[model samples]
Target chain A: MVKLKGAISGLGKMGLSHAAIVGAHPEVDIVSVCDTSTLVLDAFKRFTKVKTYTDYQKMIDNESLDFVVIATPTRIHYEMVRYALEKGIHTFCEKPFSLTIREGEDLVTLANQKKLVNQVGYHNHFIGTFRDLKRLLDTDVLGDLVHFTGEAYGPVVIKEKSGTWRSDPKEGGGCLFDYASHVINLIQEIIGRPTKANGSQLKRIYSKEVDDAVYSILTLESGLSGVLSVNWSDETYRKMSTSLTILGKKGKIICNASEMKIYLKEANSKENLGKGWTIKYITDFAIPVNFYLRGEEYSAQIANFVDCIIRKSQTEINSFKQALITDKVIELLIADSKN
Target chain B: MKMDKVLFGDNQFFAVNHLSDEKSREQAIRFKDDAAIIRVLDQAREIGISTFMCTTHDRIANVCDYVRANPEKYRGFKIYPCMPYAHKYANAVTDLGIIGTIKQYIPGNIFSTFTKGGVAFIRKDFIGFMELFIDAEMKMFKGINTPVIFIQNVLVDLILGLKMFDVFKEYDSYIRKKYNAEPGYITMNLPALLDSLNSIGIENPIICSSINKIGFRMSGGINIYEKYLTEKTFRPIALQVLAAGALRPKEAIEYIGKFPKIESVLFGASSKSHIQETKELIEQYL
Candidate 1:
């Protein structure tokens, strides 16, 4: 099989994870890796013999790459994504497509005009439970979605930190942009785009630059109203924990990383699952991948991207256009948090 | 003319007891009559609080009638109506259904009101419905000097959450052009509302919200609120400064008075002594 050669920018945690996944995948080659830190580039060089560059633009110019994975800070996403798209390279960017709605819209327009395969790294979409939930929703088993509640809590930034860019409002939008982005994407995936939203973003423990907790109420285009609560300062959770409960007229789907429970008033689907409630563990349906860091989602998402490019088909991945919706919602929620 | 530095709130008169159910019930029973409501307003006026920041409760229409009737007694009395008094419409909806509720509360030109309602419904012109609703809410405060009108927190936060910037713009323009009053917003989240107002070209708006020391009912907490109060440009009218009676009168007044941009402190008092004591505290601390 002809492998798609790709480069990755910003060797942070997500960057390294994506690099490992892409390198392990049979149909992809890590052509180059770019980061501002020489130490990061040196570490990547040791792991794989791919060329490394401190300058992302230099790497884009030098390497004839098929696509570039961006896992940079929120502020720099606009410039990097624009540069790669302008160069006609299919791009995969991390969450929070851009800081502003205008920038996100511009990127989406450009990518569509160029007919490039663009995707945002909302990896939760690729998770086994979420995918199953989406399938159930698609099957109309749950009937019309009435509401959904998404909660994401973790111990990422419990205390005031000075060094990291994640703490900076300009670079990263703290917990609201970082953590809540996942919840928003999942909500959008289950229910259609939110027509309206109201919520609060609180800076409970972090510095004034970014918020540590967020609570929002969103109304989807289908009149499905939902709530999202995310707090990164909660130390009770051992790691980043996320759960979503989707309530519909007929039934409800409650899903987390570990398991998904479906409670139905009446059976509606062909899947031999019993009537009142059915529970499925992640291990029961999770697709085993070659590389795993958090979950198989990283590998699954990368594979989907590659499959779309190789097949020359319309990408099933969440495009820049789709991700822009989430950004717009975030902007509104952040505005709601002010005062 | 500038509004009073201390605006008397009508929450006490409306029986909005946040702390206890029994107090709420007792207050509700005590202020069941318009005479009782006017007695408190009279007490507030005696304390030199000329401005009454109040909801457009059904009883307030009677209060407006009383003030308009006794012009000499209420000389220079002003009301900043915080609308749409949600309970009125909620009760109306419960009793009269949707269209009947509209007919019951909608003021003036019944034919034109129904015409607009029909067209707005067919076209889904939410802005039209919102303007009509605002006009209807403002009917109770007619012929009164309302220099500033506030969108209640329920509606304000709903609009903010919906990203309905055009609705805010329309409200700003309608309140300015029709009523000749500055459109103010009361929200649980003050900083967010200010940002939304700024986004829609409203600079330094009059905003009343919960601003307290211990973050009681303050949506985004007190730290960011303090930053906005000190650094941002806006006329902040502090409410819930006592944090639902959490802080002592002295401590609450002093903490709020320390904020440089606070133009007014809005408090509710049903008694003459409480009103007098609150005025004295503001004078001493603020």
Candidate 2:
């Protein structure tokens, strides 16, 4: 198969990171970059040693690119994805597929009609431990799962000093849009979409007109409950962390990302196991596993996209249908918060 | 003349709840000397309603010290301290040792010196620099002539808990429906804060307001006090409570005219000029 060429738009931190990684990959080439800010573009250009442009359309017009990674603010997602897909280039975009489900649906339809590869950035779920846990659930290794819970928290933002895009609701702003997608995507990938979605979104405590925090719950189609909690106002000022605890008929699994601890207990067991488990008096045993990913999901995603292009296979790496469901879940959560 | 008791409270809008703040108690204690509080408290007295005092573990001393300094102004009115710590620390089911603390500090009492470092008997046990307020209130109301009003500090803690706003809303609705006709003083929670109050035996109680963090400026420096007030359902309740305890005398009269339910308002003061302005607002409203 021929190697693919990739370009990154919005040479911000995420853009620069993606560019550096793409430049280093053997099967992919970081051919070009784009951003409205010349200073950002120039800095990213020097760091990645790649050509840069101020406009994305111009980059698409000039470069012979295999794919464009849309790392711009969420508001630009629809336009950027559409422009790239229109040119028959596979596109990789950030989460919050777009601000609304309608836009997400449009992107999905376009990706399907043109037979192009579309991947949304939900790499956190690509962690080796999560992959192992998904496998365990698939094989009923944990018994009938009853509940899936996620808790994520971080320091509150009192000022716009961190960045300006977050404070503006129009730029895919607010905690729900900015952060909750990771939780939503993880849960959807594990238990499937919720039969019902309802929960709260906190816009502010002292600050006005912007969401500073959010807490939500989603009930899945399998009668298993999923709770997604996120707070930006924790006074302790900790970094972002999300942990998932899955309760099964015989045991429970606790996976805390921030602490890097995973504890498993089979019901009515005398022994507590960490990595491997063997029990006699219990109906089931819980096992804990962990590993690292060198952008395997992103690389696998791109490789899968390329394969779909060459062999005309169906594209299914966190596909548009799944992302659209995530969009709808976000919409419902925001609505719950407002009421 | 009939006396009316009106309670006004702010929706604690800070991202961090009061309990979550490492300095919440200390911060509240330091603000005890803030001249604005005395002015507001004095203004409430001038309006002819009983002066109501709010309690925080960190700031209870400030209110206690002010009342001690001005015995004459606060003669007939009693200081109703909402004992928050007891409820916070002691659980009958989980910790039986805390019951003694509750037995000592009751809500109603006039403290000669409300100091954070004072001592009181929690049942037979003597502990702390601050009084255990729950025990004191039970004593104050044993057979008192004036009816004793017990406002649950739970809702206040809930506000300080800084959970989801919807939790506040759910509790607000439940409290109002259950306690609307029940007698005695209860702090008015949000339109939704009443639920938790009802769950704990108090129903549909009146809520109070204290405008603290709501006065902050927004992105363009717009004073969002009005917007915050409207969004939290305080406007209608303010109309109901304008005439009661601890408010400017003239403001009380005008507020009473606007809403007949208001008989008194609770005011906090910090300086002579602030007190004088409150008096003027009251006089003008009158």
Whole-model lDDT per candidate: 0.77, 0.51
Q: Compared with the true structure, what per-residue lDDT tens digits does model 2 show for residues B215-266? A: 1101111133234344432222232122222233454445434433333444
lDDT of 1 by residue, B120-216 (tens): 3523455566677788788888788999999887667655643446678888998999898888988766777788789889998998887877765
Q: Candidate 2: misplaced stretches above 4 Å?
A: A44-49, A156-163, A205-207, A235-237, A257-315, B1-286
- Model 1 misplaced regions, further than 4 Å: B1-286
In angstroms and one decimal each, the interface RMSD of every candidate reads: 24.3, 27.6
Q: Candidate 2 residues A1-339, lDDT tens each?
A: 467888888755456545544553446767788988664553344333567798789999899998888888889999999999999998878777888778888999999899887878776554444555565567664677877787665554534333356556778766677667777777788656765666665656433445767776778877777777866544343234555677777566654321122334542242334433431110011111110012234434444554565566666557767877888888887777767
Docking class of 1: incorrect
A99, model 1: CA deviation in Å? 1.0
True interface contacts reproduced by each model, as a fraction? 0.00, 0.00
Model 1, A1-339: lDDT tens digits are 668899889876668667766765668888888888665564445434689898889999999989999988889999999999999999999987889999999998999898888999988888777888888788888877777999998766655544357667787657888889888888887667776777565655754577788887888887878888998877554356788998888888888765788898987558766789887756455555543334567777888888788877656658788889899888878777774
Lowest lDDT sum, 10 consecutive residues, model 1 chain B, at: B90-99
